[model samples]
Target: MSASGAKTNLHEFVVQENEQVAEGLWRMRCNTALAAELAPGQFVQVSVPADASHILRIPLSFARADARSGELDIVYAVVGEGTRRLSAMAVGQASTMVGPCGNGWWLPQDQGRALLVAGGVGLPPIFACASMLAQTGVGFDVVVGAQTASRHCVGYVDELRSMGIHEGCDCARKVVLTTDDGTLGMRGFVTQAMENLLAEHTYAQVYACGPNPMMAGVAKLSMSKDIACEVSLERMMGCGFGACSCCNVALVDGTQALCCTDGPVFDARRVQWQTR
Candidate 1:
């Protein structure tokens, strides 16, 4: 949150695993010391090697970091030319990256039970969030939705158990899932699942990440339930260090904030959601 210096720390990363997790989602693991500084909801900006073929670096949100092992894991969806090249990176090859950039989520201790909702690639950051919530000793419910179940992994549940969340049966059921094709659990949107949770429990706060549309739905649901919520944002950037003005964002309050430096995580009420 310091004003004005390059927050991005440049490093070289070797591709460990770049496998397709679902239809359009890819789970990528990289080797870097940046794992120590990275937190849930933060991201790394990676340069797709310098060449005529690809010069731009794509911004990817960090799902989790293994500080002891010096490894960083990210989940990204193929969306543009840069991502296409990145998705095809072979194991052991190196990629240049700069980060652990952007603001992360804040877990208030007084906030009772937590509710987490995610869509597609956005589910990555929330993985670490579960650990953070566990550290507070508060019970949390996480719900993720996708187009299919081939990408499903309940690693979050195991993580919470590791952190000592003793809510046995209920916590196990906390992970409500949905797929558009009915491949796994519920056959609907993430919002529908969130709505159901909201109806059952008055969440202390809500956290979400996903496409703008999904985030918008979460914002509306949070407002309806009178729950404070925060979201991790994604934006196009020329430089992840805040040197370039490419990632500027206008919040709902008419104040301009830098997505790279000010936040990738913002309170749901602060974002300019309706127009985006």
Candidate 2:
């Protein structure tokens, strides 16, 4: 079930624009009603057209959703056959998608600035989270990372910077870009930038989406500081809903939860990072 208490449904979507945004990364805009229903951190299961034999849908999270425009932007990496096929889809092509799946990021319980960390394609949800914060008059700082300069999305960074200028927002926002190969702003992991920020300033909450190891590191740092943190986890889902049970997330409580339904977003402390 979605946060709005509605059962997931198949929605028809038309591709508006599908083009390469960064090396090996493609940004796609789709016209669909699902845009209004989606919350930050939630994902959609899209059935790639022209592949009746391939039953599995590609699960993707959106970078932006404009309810008025009835459009959503998805930033995806061309990793395998499914995504490669998705990249080939032409503008005006129509397809079916199941959404708005899973829970989304929750606002911080206490009032203070928050920190956002994103790596690679993880930038989408993190960008969405920043938008949510901006709309609610919450202040935030961002750290975006990629393997190298070519893999980074400068457009999202610019969008994040613009959030600092929101009408009611009074606090200054800091946006940091990091690349492992030292080809960009900072040379090192997002964690390294996060560490420096944590040391210099205090934050009420932290939000992150990235590879397991990177998120684990973020969770550890947040826990040590006694700060609340939320992380969006990625899993392979045969069924985007709960039926297949392929996307199990091990919790610290010795139980397993389905990532597709229970969460793609979860409390950082509750997850068993070792299992990931």
Candidate 3:
């Protein structure tokens, strides 16, 4: 996931669309040339003007990016003031965005079958990766989870739609959804869904993003099976660039790694699960 594309810097972007897909969850689209420069698994640090009290920019993954339209889609769950401010943005409002940052997922050359595990708001980068994989005819399956069935509506449906994935879509059967309360496709977490898939399919690789606990399980599972795996890490980041040490994460080597630079994505085997 080496940084690629145009120079990364602050860019003025106007909100093209903003809509709430579910409780406290929003899907925001903004017009910016930088969208064309973004690679799958990368993130943008956004400054919500309404949050004058918070100086740190909120990091968000690219749910979808249309280089031709110069529109970047950001799917997020509002957990605090910064994100609440971000969700309030009205169409045409402007903000400062810096990104296309962080080392992203390692795409395999084989392009064989792969598994994608997503949980809660971690769907963006994984969704972006799916889009690219589908375009290249890489056979893949997805296991996504949320707290409840309703929580599953938070841009997951729309995100899949935007990617041309639907009930009747070619990859429809490959996508599985799960929830904690039996309110969705399956009544369990994504890990259970992944376990079922692994039993029936032989995947060449695994890609995952989500809460640390969930990712830890996926990483552990992948490692147990000796399957190559990559994980996108989530951390509180202030600056989009490496200058800010706020997003540092512990590594397997007993060293600190910056999620904003070294990676928001890393080989699953390289992460130190205990430290998380």
TM-score of each: 0.87, 0.97, 0.92
Full-model lDDT for every candidate = 0.78, 0.93, 0.83
Which 10 residues in a row give candidate 2 its minimum summed lDDT? 163-172
Instruction: Find the candidate with the highest TM-score and give its number.
Output: 2
Candidate 3 CA-lDDT value: 0.83
Cα lDDT of model 1 overall?
Answer: 0.78
Ranking by TM-score: 2, 3, 1
Worst 10 residues of 1 by lDDT: 1-10
- What's the distance in Å from true for residue 204, model 3? 0.5
Q: lDDT tens string, model 1, 152-227? A: 6555434533554454534443778888889988999999999888888868888898888899899998988789
User: Candidate 3 versus the native: TM-score?
Assistant: 0.92
Candidate 3 local lDDT, 1-276, one digit each (tens): 337655678878999999887666788989998888888998888888964678888888988888899999998998988888888899999988887788767777667788999998888899898887877667788888888877775456545544544465555437888898888789988999999999998889999999999999999999999899999998877776878688888888999999888889999888899644
List candidate 3 stretches off by more than 4 Å: 158-173
- Model 1 vs. true fold: TM: 0.87
Q: Candidate 3, 255: how far from true, in Å?
A: 1.8
Cα lDDT, model 2, residue 101: 94
Q: Between candidates 1 and 2, name the one with more favorable TM-score.
A: 2
